[model samples]
Target: MGNILCDGSPIESDPRYRFQGRQWETSMMDAPCNNCKGCFLAMFCPCCFAYHLRVLALEGRMENYSCCQGYLCPTCTSKCIPGQDSCPEFCLCLEVTLCENFAISSTRFYIQDQRQIMTDPCDNRIIRFNNCVQILSFVCHILAIFFRELRHLAHLLDLFADLVYCMVQACMQAQTHHELTLHPTAVDYGQAPRTITQQPTASDKAPLMGHQAPPAYSE
Candidate 1:
């Protein structure tokens, strides 16, 4: 019992160092410089700064991180997407729009993406056309017939009225039919639309398209 107490004091201890048990020597390293809000916090790794920023972006706290909100360069300001450093100031991201439901009668706008929306009412033009068509159709059909039966034939007044009414009815049908043919979903494929130009001949020597030749060859 006496010998056991005297010699047992000599004991070994384990090291607290992380690299002590490892086969390879571990190197102590410094992080990269993270220019966050000009605080100049140098990071332990360049990879880590990006990781942190991405995490911040995903968490919807990009504004909280000064480094993320700060624009790195002009290119970043121009090209960055939403939730990114140098993102667009105000952005709109709409995947689709069915024009049939669009409405702009109210000043209020529905904001789904980063930007406010602009609406325009659909089918209103159809309503207007229907209203106009009803009035014109009634007058042209009824009044033209009445005029033919009541008015004298030698004067040819009734015939003229009938012709004019027929023209009006034909025009209404044609215009409405043309409007009905318009489909918003149909993509034009970038073809230059036909525009009527009251273009004078080259011999006429017009001044220009928009500018009027200020009363030339006049007193």
Candidate 2:
């Protein structure tokens, strides 16, 4: 009939409700304010939670909210980390001193000079980057030259191929003309021979035993 937890325990029946190391000694029915809800149930108002945390932060009372074992804003958090001690993680200002008001490091610490420390390794990233830039520059130069020369080379190649094709065509045409001509110009100019020949006359033939034949006809 009441609000139940995961283990089937009722909120009304649960005994221990601890907060801020203080125990809720009384029953829920007895303490009307036990479940007042929202910000009233919280340590401070939502807005005040932030404000108080900030105040604490400046005061340097907090190490962090986890040490408080609960959630607190940046203000109350700083308050929990006691002043004079350094918390490099949250210390915004690189100060040997502390203040709850400032957010960033306004103070300075003794940082060792790089010259005093060991020399740094040569960064290949910088070398590789420089080399890449140089390579790109060289490529760009080559492309520029290639673009200018490509058109001229193409034109020359086209002209050369055209010349070769024309020469080959001329040679082929000359050979064909020599082999297949109907008339041989300038060489065979004379007339062609006649088709028919004349026959000889009968009077022109002579007899072998001749003289006798003419006398018999007269008788």
Candidate 3:
């Protein structure tokens, strides 16, 4: 007789076998302590707490995460190109533009990473660069009026921003390094490639000597 369990097994087949699979690990941090020494530190120094929070909730190494984003912000050093005529102002403008792109793109990357790990769908959507700054600024001012400790919330946000800024810079540097490694040009090499100047041969020099007068007869 053909077996009837073509796809998934019937629910009534077994009760003990279903519970044996490996458990999935969570990527979220636990709630901070309330009354202990840790809580005191967290309350007094929320920036440090946020750093710890980020380090904990993440699944893999922080370097890996930053490296992934770093490749996106490749560096363009036109000024360093060999023999290429590049104006000072143009290079300066490009550098400034690259910096701006790095900041904006890096912030976006951080926000996206945060969204993936966040537990609340609504909160994830609400937490963004512009929204975070504006909302937190307003909230900080209002809360500071009531709770004295809340004044530090602004500082916490600043610290977090600073951290992201540094991370973005790191990503940019890493990507630039990677790009340079991949394409080492003549300029990047110790010196620009030497041009082969054509040496004058006997035939070429004979023409020039043809017009010259004979050696002086004064012997």
Candidate 4:
């Protein structure tokens, strides 16, 4: 028995053996590559193109894929008049755009996090990555071969951390400490010195008006 077709007929007996049927023509794999404009449009905005393609596929209508038809619907509903089905399409487009924006923002944050992980030796990210790699190596021993090498690499990284610490310390020491510390004799224009006051001794006190002096006692 030769190859059998889906309709329970031999491939050779089928009239459309070589994809001559409409089914084959409509298939995604058989979609023509002649439309360079469509290709570029899809390439630039795959999400929009995919939504359009999905609509066309489900509706089985070629007219629905017209340029005027927005990504959400098979008609020009840009005005968004009430009682029209355009609201759903507009909401869908908005959702896709928002999701794409969020994905882009998340990717940027992930890239920044990765950069921080690679640059900052103090963080445990490197160690955690190394541990993850070693654990993965259990499933594939090719990584196990580099076990000693990774340890050496970790040591080198620690050395680099020490070097960075020393460099920071040297930089700090090289800076003028005079700028940070106050001079012992420097006058502060912002404030005035407080005057020192002391209580007068009894002998130093002058006699009050109308107050008689005490009689002196003999030693």
Candidate 5:
């Protein structure tokens, strides 16, 4: 099947899809400095910021924004709940409120997939950091079995690492938002309806032949 926007409009002709793979215009570390407003919003009000980014991924159509990029309800369009026509918005809000990290990650993945943007070194670094934290946490758990004091330390380390991870994720979201602003998707939603006019064909313009022509009139 061809590429479609969140609003279910076909976007096979979108310019962004013309290039199969490309790197982000700005790195994650530089995003906060480049777009201070986005960074501030992301850091201070991540839930709202995540929702806004999701809408941006949908080409600025708030109505088209979905919770988890509609992966939770692949078959349901517009409304995920039975007999409820306007449940998507509520669902999205709830998702952002309760599952902020998942919501933000889904939006980021959606944007990247639509634009064919590849993960950069910064993304790999974040992944490595998370991996290292997990490994350390496991080691700490094993060490805590012998040393009771290490148990408290492990809890403290986990809490600190979680805070740092959240901060890093917020920055990543800001970076994605800034990059999206620089290179917006070309979805058809929220635009004026198009009107198509059919041009006259060659046969329609051809002169009438033989008997089909009108008889010559006398002066």
Candidate 6:
């Protein structure tokens, strides 16, 4: 008979281990209202917002976060790219500007992992809705290939779906920024050692008085 208990692997070695974490503090829809600044940045300039979130995830250590840190960098090197040292800010700027979605998603995942925050149900629903819309748009495109009348409608659907998807991404980024504010990392406290100076009072400045010698000893 094969020994079932003889395996030397650790219990956590299983790839199917369930992730345990707390739920998000606020839903994505509510996040924008909760943090107006974050929402404004996300909606107007998503690339900058994504880069800010990446930095926030690393506890404000901008140098630590690089372009495609975990995705492209299989080895997860500290440097932006292996061997050739590159500026983190430049690489991250390029990443967020060119690959905004990937940058935002990666930063979200990184923050979630570090803080052990579970994905909100609203996020799942939005993602599913986006996927369904994309599929429907693709189907519309396919049908338009045969029915020429649907070509304009298909193009419109594609454009609308893409716009919605972009909006959803922006909202999610705003939500992430809000969440970071709610649960700040230790480094956010600004706990660097500081020397405190106190003014000297008259009592403190008084010289130490020696005990008087006995009169008999003086004689």
- Per-residue accuracy of model 1 over 1-219 as CA lDDT, tens digit each: 334222212112201111111110111111011212211211222223223322322243433322222222324533443433343212211100111011110000111000111111112222233334334444444454456553233224334533433332222222222221231111321332232223211122101001011111111
In the range 79-122, model 2's lDDT, one tens digit per residue, is 65554245433433322123311111100000001001111112
lDDT of 6 by residue, 148-216 (tens): 787788878888777766667777787888778877773343333222233212122111101111111
Among all candidates shown, the one with the greatest lDDT: 6
Task: Name the runs in model 1 displaced over 4 angstroms.
Answer: 1-155, 184-219
Compared with the true structure, model 6 gives a TM-score of 0.65
- Which candidate leads in TM-score? 6
- The superposed Cα distance between candidate 2 and the true structure at residue 142, in angstroms, equals 19
Per-residue lDDT of model 3, residues 76-104, tens digit only: 23223322233323322332244443323
What would the TM-scores of all predictions be? Answer: 0.17, 0.17, 0.25, 0.21, 0.62, 0.65
lDDT of 5: 0.57
Q: What lDDT would each prediction earn against the true structure?
A: 0.23, 0.25, 0.30, 0.28, 0.57, 0.59
Decide which is better by TM-score, 3 or 5: 5
The better-scoring model by lDDT among 1 and 6 is: 6
Candidate 1 accuracy as TM-score: 0.17
Model 6 Cα RMSD, 1 decimal: 27.0
lDDT of 6 at 185: 79
Alpha-carbon runs more than 4 Å astray in model 3: 1-149, 185-219
Please list the residue runs of candidate 4 whose C-alpha ends up more than 4 Å from where it truly belongs after superposition: 1-22, 26-32, 54-86, 98-219
Q: What TM-score does candidate 3 reach?
A: 0.25
Model 3 pairs whose backbones collide: none
* Predicted candidate 4 versus true structure: per-residue lDDT over 73-114, tens digit per residue: 224344543432434455445433554322221221222121
Task: Write the number of the candidate with greater TM-score, choosing between 5 and 6.
Answer: 6
